[model samples]
Target: MPSPTHDALRTPAWTPPAGNTKPPLSSRMMRAAWRGLPARRYDVGWEPGLVVPAPDGSPLITDHYFPRAAGDFPTLLVRSPYGRGVPWSPMYGLLFAEQGFHVILQSCRGTGGSGGRFGLWRNEAADGRATVSWLREQPWFDGTLGTIGASYLGYVQWALAMDPPPELKAMVVQVGLHDPHAFFHANGALNLENALVSGVGMAYQHQGLAPMVKATLRLQRRLREITTARPLRGAQASVVGDVPWLDDAMTHADADDPHWLGTSMGQAAERLDVPTGLITGWHDALLDQTLEQYGRLRRAGCDTALLVGPWTHTSAFQRGWPEVFAESLAWLRAHLCDDPSGLRPTRVRVHTGGDESWRDLDDWPSSPAVTSWFPAPDGQLLQQAPTDAEPLASFRYDPADPTPSVGGPLLSRGAGPRDNGALEAREDVLTFTGPPLTEPVDVLGPVSARLSVSTDTGYADVFARLCDVDAQGRSTNVCDGLVRLRTTGQAPTRVTVPMSSTAHRFAAGHRIRWQISGGAHPRYARNPGTGASPVDATEFLPVRITVHADSELTLPRGAAGTVKDRGQPRS
Candidate 1:
């Protein structure tokens, strides 16, 4: 493979045609829908299909959007594999251009007519550098550059940070991913549903809306059959049409596996000096990755800001776009344009669940108090630890009848908080509930479950979830985690399951609940008790999992008092 810039060709920037400079009707409608988006300061002009040479001399197709006004503006680069049309053209290209930015929206390798095969994360760094080099030679390039996008687009930004150009000044990573390994195999378990959803999107989304929709429908129609395949490895290829990248991701479960080396851009966060604005939702699939990068950036003393909403991966771009757009625009203006007036005073802003309100804090986890609730044999969550050693609460997990996944932090549309009443009614699920809270309790940090567990079959998975039980007894999942276990037969092992992080409140009259299950099927691949790879397992076995009375759920409690209201977020 030739280096991305090994024989880079200088390409002339396409001049925008002198035509109507008014915002398109679609752009106007989108702007209207996002109530708090920055006012459009200039009409936009677009120059499409500008060719930039990738490092290996492949043509990376790009589109340029600039203000129709007569003034220089900082450029914002948004490279995506998910096509350069529809939402991308309007949301990032037009919107940012109208806000006085010269937006360069490009298609990644092997997508949207760009030359070369898409090698997932492999081609981003060099392609990004080559694009920047091309930008430097453009007449409209003002030398100041910023990158912005969500999901895979965010991954490209991190890849660019690996060898950041001097012109790169700021970045906005929304629900982005930095580690492919963690995204696919979190806690040694395959994130099956997300993997499939992502695979479908990557394979077909850039092709066009119709193909993407058709592929999505096909996957949905065959989802059950695909997920339940005895040997899971080849099932995905049948649905997505031979996606080698997805296959490779599913095969490598170990982070240290040679296949995943250099795939993580976490080091970029730790060393990046550019001003970065991070955005995510409590229910977003990449929530943990966003928080992880925030911590790393903060520790490195990098200028960073974080915004977390009450949204899932897709909803963040829809319902949460107003706040998301405002935050991004403010951060960009502050850093790139040297205009900090719109920036918030605090570094962190998060929306608290239950209350459905936003709060600004000096730092994440603004509270230091931790509360532990022990699970008793009587299915109660008690503040005090148990003294008596009682028989363990037990449930059987059958791979043939895996516990179905409910709404949570998933990439699919079926993600976010959902009523778990039906799921908890299953025999394989265990729930421990605490008394109704007289005063609302705010939990604003990491949530975890510590378990003393044993399994008859030696191999199993422990899925722990935290929920808020409302007055009507509807249980809504807040955060959850799963750990694949390999233990000695019947010997209890103590393990701590990090159930992600959340900013939620247990409202008055609401009860706190801790749910324990063997596994959340399809969300995570079912564990076969024969010590076989889930992808290649030919045999399914039932395992009896037991939880001891000593197990506890730990929650970070915010300070007692009303969290200062940050006012209603626009839209």
Candidate 2:
């Protein structure tokens, strides 16, 4: 057989085939949701278990693939904490290699076959730069490199790109956490459920128990028990054995602590100059961070494109969207192959949930209009801010019987958008509904609430959700947020909660709803109301929360006449 490195394997530059002039917002979803990867596109050659030395001489194992019909091609690199074979290899290594690109999948230090102690996000920067230097010395490497992957895999791309390597050309960053602190501390409270599960999962992964970790990742019932267990600090030991990092994370509640500064990629991300694409789901846990990353890159004059769908962190990887792969490849080609026509320098495409279609915008937050809704004493949501002091809406929050999590971006089973009817009916949760809308209201950006609340306990947590109430009174969540507060003084304090951004249309006759309460258990750690660390708080204090009537919820809306029926522009 001819050597796989033969000039014949050198394929012509790839170009995105021309499609509709005005492309559908979700052409990928419209196509059969891709199951697994399509059969290999080009004849491919794979070399497994190739070891490269890091600067410190620690070994990083990689699997390399190149088209059998081969010529030198721009290489695509995927550096992941996951093993470099099986799962990640098939999706990225083999799939991209067969598509006429040189692909390399390297296991990050301390996981897979790589040598070095795993320090989670802290180790990627140095390891990534070392891998790039190794790639440069490869016979097939053409000095052009592009990176792709989602979640942690995607995060490594940004972590390395913070100080862009000259060989690095573009990246497809999907659902990645930019701030290490945000993963543990969201809005000043421990994101207990996700942090514990994720930390445990990582511990198991390093121990070579990959199958077991995947099998139990979504154990919602077990996770609930773990989060609600007494002595929160030691609860995880019962789940995945001892993980010292979990204990440290719980104790260091402040995100700005110097210890966490080393892992933050946000500062480095601002200095990036590479062409980039961001892919995230409306209900993905990292939606907020993804959006924030895009804004930062765009402001820094980096070329960027954004695509958001109605999927979860796990589902997005399982169900491949055609546009996601096509556009991502196009993006890589444009920058890595000296071809810039594959995608516009800046474009935003978001899938509006209820309408179930895509809308292309010149920029994000296409909403030129901002709408504010206020809470009324009578369980009503009013368009105008209240002029009088209405009676406070009170709810008793007992950590022992804390509100269960139901949808809207979670790290576990009940993630994504789900009905809030069951949750809304709970006495601990206070629901405020608006009258039927005269016309459809298109909400397309960040959702936030400024709640004036007073609690009887010294400390408490406030969880808020933005939902759409249909004509039939069915409530489905759109976005939500939570914050831990100190309520010792008995004075009403304003807690500003920032929910994930969304692109959804509240149809005529549908009502806007805000479900406010003390906590979203397991999703966020239940506040013990004693100003103690969530992990060590075994004493539970029932908090009586009084939400002032004038508290406000804000939704970003499209400018009058900007949003059209079916998401198309109306002349």
- Which window of 10 residues has the lowest lDDT sum in candidate 2? 16-25
**What's each prediction's TM-score?**
0.95, 0.89
Q: Give the TM-score of candidate 1.
A: 0.95
Q: Which digits, one per residue and each the tens of the lDDT, describe model 1 over residues 1-571?
A: 1123422432334344578455445666766666656677887887888899999999999988898876567899999999987678889999999898999999999999999999999999999999998987776676778999999999999999988888889999999999999999978899999999999999999998899999999988998999999799989888799888899999899999999999999999888899999999999899999999999999999999999998898888887888898899999999889999989888898888888777788898778789999987679998998885454699999999999999998887678899999999999999999999999999999999989998888999999999999999999999999999888966688889999999988899999999999899789999887889999998988999999887889999875433556544322
- Please identify model 1 stretches exceeding 4 Å from their true place: 1-17, 20-36, 388-390, 560-571
Q: Which regions of candidate 2 fall more than 4 Å away from where they truly are? A: 1-40, 205-210, 213-221, 339-346, 559-571
Q: Please, what are the lDDT tens digits per residue for candidate 2 over residues 126-185?
A: 788988877766667666788998778877887888787887878888778778788788
Total backbone collisions for each predicted model: 3, 6
Clashing pairs in 1: 4-55, 4-56, 5-55
In terms of lDDT, which candidate is strongest?
A: 1
Best by TM-score: 1
